[model samples]
Target: MPRSATDLLDLSELPAPQRREVRDFVQFLLTRQAGAKKPAASYRFSDLCGTMAWKGDAVAAQRSLRDEW
Candidate 1:
């Protein structure tokens, strides 16, 4: 889940053992459903759509989406 490579990314910067606490809270946020909230797949599709238009082709973009299943 780390988007970067650095020791400064860990919870050592906190005052106590709150890493697990923070992780749980973030996981809850990711899985939460409110109103028109959608899963991670929706965003992936948006990403694919964006690239497809940029590259002038949508064939590989669609295949990338199917691979998620």
Candidate 2:
């Protein structure tokens, strides 16, 4: 509920280990924010979509999959 960084935490009053935990949490937030600001990596599945060539009978394949054999 703190409005500013200075008011956000009393790191001085925290034990050293707890202070380190806060520092780590802040670092994680910063890194997460940085990642959010950037565009995500893209993937191109189109190139691999139809790369495999099927030589068998198409209708037979469909029927077999339906347990219609």
Candidate 3:
């Protein structure tokens, strides 16, 4: 029978160096997959956005609060 893509690995058959190489490749693929995920839409946070926009110097107010902390 043909082995499925998810067939069990026989790491014991691989040389130590080859096993390390395979492990590194798997990690690389996982990292690439994580970064390839689509970002959320620009309007995803639209509702919570303008909720914090005030007319005054919000940056100065934030700095002052941070200094107090």
Candidate 4:
């Protein structure tokens, strides 16, 4: 049998309600993936896409500078 990432994520040890929560959260994350370089995700209270912008390594370097420290 082939094992996908989600097949193992559905741990049988978890309770029914907890299992449902896990399933829903996983689906939510899949939907949130906006085909960007960043792995950032946010929840939407309203029916709107929580935008994810991917500013790459330049931002990280700036943040790590002495002035930022």
lDDT of 1: 0.61
Per-model CA lDDT versus the true structure: 0.61, 0.80, 0.74, 0.72
Question: Which parts of model 4 have CA positions greater than 4 angstroms off?
Answer: 1-4, 34-69
* Error of model 1, residue 48, in angstroms: 41
Cα deviation of 65 in candidate 2 (Å)? 6.6
Instruction: Please list the residue runs of candidate 1 whose C-alpha ends up more than 4 Å from where it truly belongs after superposition.
Output: 1-10, 33-69
Query: How many clashing pairs in candidate 2?
Result: 0
lDDT, residue 47, model 4? 50
Cα deviation at 62, candidate 1, in Å, is 58
**Which candidate leads in lDDT?**
2
What does the lDDT read for residue 51 in candidate 4? 60
Highest TM-score model number: 2
Clashing pairs in 4: none
- Give per-residue lDDT, candidate 3, residue 15: 95
| Full-model lDDT, candidate 3 | 0.74
Comparing 3 and 4 on TM-score, the stronger one: 3
lDDT agreement of model 4 with the native:
0.72
Give model 4's TM-score versus the native structure.
Answer: 0.40
Per-residue lDDT of candidate 4, residues 4-54 (tens digit): 446767479999888888888877777676455576678675557566666
Q: Which 10 successive residues of model 3 have the least lDDT summed?
A: 3-12
TM-score of each: 0.31, 0.53, 0.42, 0.40
* Candidate 3 clash figure, as a count: 0
